[model samples]
Target: MTTCATELLDKLASRRAIVAVIGLGYVGLPLIRAVAESGLTAIGIDTDPTKIEMLKAGRNYLKHTGGEWIAPLVEAGRLRPTGDFATLAEADVIVICVPTPLTRHMQPDLSYVEATARSIAPHLAPGRLVVLESTTWPGTTTEVLKPILETSGLSCGRDFFVAFSPERADPGNAEYDATGRIPKVIGGDGAEAREAACAFYGLFVERIVPVENAATAEAVKLFENIFRSVNIALVNELKVVYRAMGIDIWQVIEAAKTKPFGFMPFYPGPGLGGHCIPIDPYYLSWKAKEFDVRSQFVELAGEINSAMPRWVVDRLAEALDRSAGTGLSRAHVLVVGIAYKKNVDDTRESPALRLIELLESRGARTSFHDPWAPVIPPTREHAALGGRRSVPLDPATIADYDAVLIVTDHDNVDWSALAEARLVVDTRNRAEREGLAGPRLVKL
Candidate 1:
């Protein structure tokens, strides 16, 4: 039997193994940069030819990729983002960072991960280490992914190696680099696979926690994101109830965070946004149903977070109804911040998108002002309004709009500019700025 510790040490010392990273998106792109920066040349594989061209031209599509750094790095020959799969046969260490986004029903969509594995399987060889970093259900690595890899008459842990190492990268956090911000959790088929997986991540991560099998590693990522989804939902629920009681949920949370033990705070938002929190929980919920278990917290959190758009719309309607000289039908609402969260440009599954739609449906004319996202695309209720780019932080324009809604609290927004507005709906609790705050603020 292959020993985990021995296998890992051998792979690293051999540095002759070509590093291959599949799926060059938010996660894969950063990882490719890290692998290249680590003094080893890695092959970045992506199906999107445009993305490949962007990489070749030294332009990264992700908002977090910071064109300043990636541009110079790609100028060198350390990384090559290619559309070829034949590179898989040349890899010693292969990390799969494909998307595990939810389907229309919020079910685990493994088509990319599974299909990628099948495609790479034909070229998979002995002594190659395979690690999956995509957020997924618990048994995906050992069950769904392994079957596909073994389809080429190759056995896992025997003929080759397989493991799961859940990626915990916070896309927008400048402090959390791919190499060291968080410790990596690794699990595999057995002791050997576990060690090999640990050794591989040990090269970049601060530390590694090895478990008995790949399922455990997969579960770790799901549980971490699910915790955030539930806590945020809890606050979202509390925000509504507390508003009725005339107590600010944000105030209560800030006070409750003082308890040293058993308490960590997750702020309330318009909805759970981004690729992880909104999608990872559903992976568990979908898998739970297969085993006759109902993940109630996950389901409830999902339902509550998803419904926040409607609630925000209702609140915007109420804001307009209560306004002094205008009706909801004629009110011009300016939503500040459209990205999923503050300081990040990524808007995948952003709650602000839904909120914008809800506002427009009620006859409230809406324009967004996001420093990151210049243009707002149409969703369920909004038409494709051309040139609806983010407006500059001008108090005159703020005064022109009847109401200014704070959907996302990105860093650069000048809250003071909107202080003189006739109405303001503060959803992300971001109206407070160093020189900003006035009587016009309405906490939602």
Candidate 2:
């Protein structure tokens, strides 16, 4: 190991290293918390002034992560949030947790990751270890990030170290919310880089699984999410087939899950949601074409999952026509739960937004009710749906809509109230599970 690498490792071991985490979204916020709680000084950097202002004031913007805990951390000087990129010079270890979204053509979009690298490159100093926690294609760590970062005139393994440690953050999942409990997978540019990363993360994270190189670590994240995308696509396809055969897909899943081995349940819903499962598979598929190989199986899964929102709307339209003698045209439809999944405020790549758009395109008056997301925020694809507020879910509000479509089954939603509605199209099988199933209730 070089002298610079030895010094960095020593700082990390004593928890004296200043850890700077870029981007203050879901993944970054939890990581900074873990670092601060582990007795290390955590510097949070984001371009958004609002996030920095809130953090400085000790107020938490994210609902899943409470506000009360943030005050003490800021008060204790263990955590410092800022919008300045120049602060990277003071950081001994920097972790990039920016967004890794897809382009409109479904290609990998590394703009956020690239921009973050450029922003900090000028401030990057020798002996500082830069780790990327953003999810992207396999070669991103070496091919993309490393080249851009080298613009600082610092040679990668010898001067400044580089590593890839993909963030596995599941927002709204209480069981997995604790960052220290989750096992972190790390891959580095070289042995020294890997050693520096593992040593830093060992301060906070409970377990560290180090891989051979950065590319493998990048593949690990894509594979983990694609596994979910494919399995979900399978159950989603089964939902359609069994629905056509007049068999209840929910009941079939319940019975099939009783087996001790070779059975794990993945439920069908309006469509794929959240950051990873919807986008990461396409990242893999896009990368596969570079090697003259087509990821047809993964691409096929993406197709099935993408089509779910429209299929759910079609079922809702059919239910309205059969039960109320009216179609979606001029019908008042209420969409329950706009957040991608239950109990989370995050609406990134949520299928419910598409369902609302589809309903309105067919001339239905659409409204949504989500306890988590009170008002829809601006999204890249669903910009038109932004600024819309969640409607009340009381009995009076429920009776006004001609048909109630349940896309996301939130635990806080009152499923029993749908019994008074004229029609209930349950995509999540929430109504039946709540003991309110009847002829007017349709399950998809």
Candidate 3:
């Protein structure tokens, strides 16, 4: 091993390394806690002062990451949150876990990742290891990140080490914690960088799978989400096809899943949501164009997934016409769960926002109810719907709506109260499973 690689591995073995995590949002915060839990000092660096203040105040801003998880680390002084990049010099290992959202034109936006690299480049020193945990297109670590860090007049794999490790974090999943149980996929520019990174992550992560190079690690992350997007799109297309044939897609999925060995079920919903599934696949599609190749499967998936909100609204309008003897114009529609998926407060890329806009554009009066998100916060894409708050889910309130649309199936909702609605458009198949069935309950 090289001198720099040897030094980092020694520090990791001794649990005396100062691990710095950049971009302390959903990915970084939990990682910091894991680093602290491994008996190393963890410093969380972010440009957002509001998040730093919240961390200092012992308050958790994310619904899935509880303050209790951070409290013990803060009290023990093992974890420190800061808005300063100069502290990068004190860190023996730095992990980048920033957001990689798509641009307005559906292209890859690496601005945040590039800016983070620039911020840390000046403070980077010899014998330190840097690992990127952000999901991005292939060749990002070696192409985009290496050049920036080399600006510090040090050589990677010699003076410093670099690696790419894609994060597999699932928000609001109680079954998975940062206890090293989830397998981590890592790759580096060279053998030394790869060994050093694997050793560092081995401190907290239980299982580490080492690949050939940084691009492979990057591809691993993209492929994982792309698989989900493609399967979801397939099921979504089948949903429309089955609907035209007078078939219920939910019932079809349940029956197909009975094969047990060959079938894994993917359900159709209002649309894709959250930070990963909806946006990460586009990063691959955009990158493929550089090689003069088209990602046709990914493109088709994007087209079908993106069009789901409109299709849902069309079904809803048809349901309204059939049951309530009215059109979408001026119809009172109650939307359940504004967050992307069930049981989480994250609303980024949530289909419910699009569904709401589509409904309102057709002259439907829309109101939403989510136990997690009481008030819709400002988002970059859906600023107009920011100020709206969740409505009460009582029997009397539900009965007032012309139709109730199930967008997200949060577990805490009073499922029985939905039985009182004049018309119910079920997109999640939740109402039927909950014993809500009648001429009024319409499954999309």
How much lDDT does each candidate structure score? 0.80, 0.90, 0.91
Model 3 misses residue 77 by how many Å?
0.9
Pull out the clashing pairs in model 3. 180-206
Query: What lDDT score is found at residue 369 in candidate 1?
Result: 91
Residue 386 error, candidate 3, Å: 1.1
* Collision count of model 1: 1
- Kindly list the per-residue Cα lDDT of model 1 for residues 229-314, writing each as its tens digit: 99889999999999999998888999999999999998887887888898888888888989999999998998999998898878
Off by over 4 Å in 2: none
Worst 10 residues of 2 by lDDT: 413-422
User: Clashing residue pairs in candidate 1, if any?
Assistant: 4-192
Local error of candidate 1 at residue 368 (angstroms):
0.7
Residue 38 miss distance in model 1 (angstroms):
1.5
Model 2 clash tally?
0
**lDDT string, candidate 3, 42-120, tens digits:** 9999889999988887788887777787777888898899998999999999999998988899888999989999998
Give each model a TM-score.
Answer: 0.94, 0.98, 0.98
**RMSD (Å) of each candidate, 1 decimal:** 2.4, 1.0, 1.0
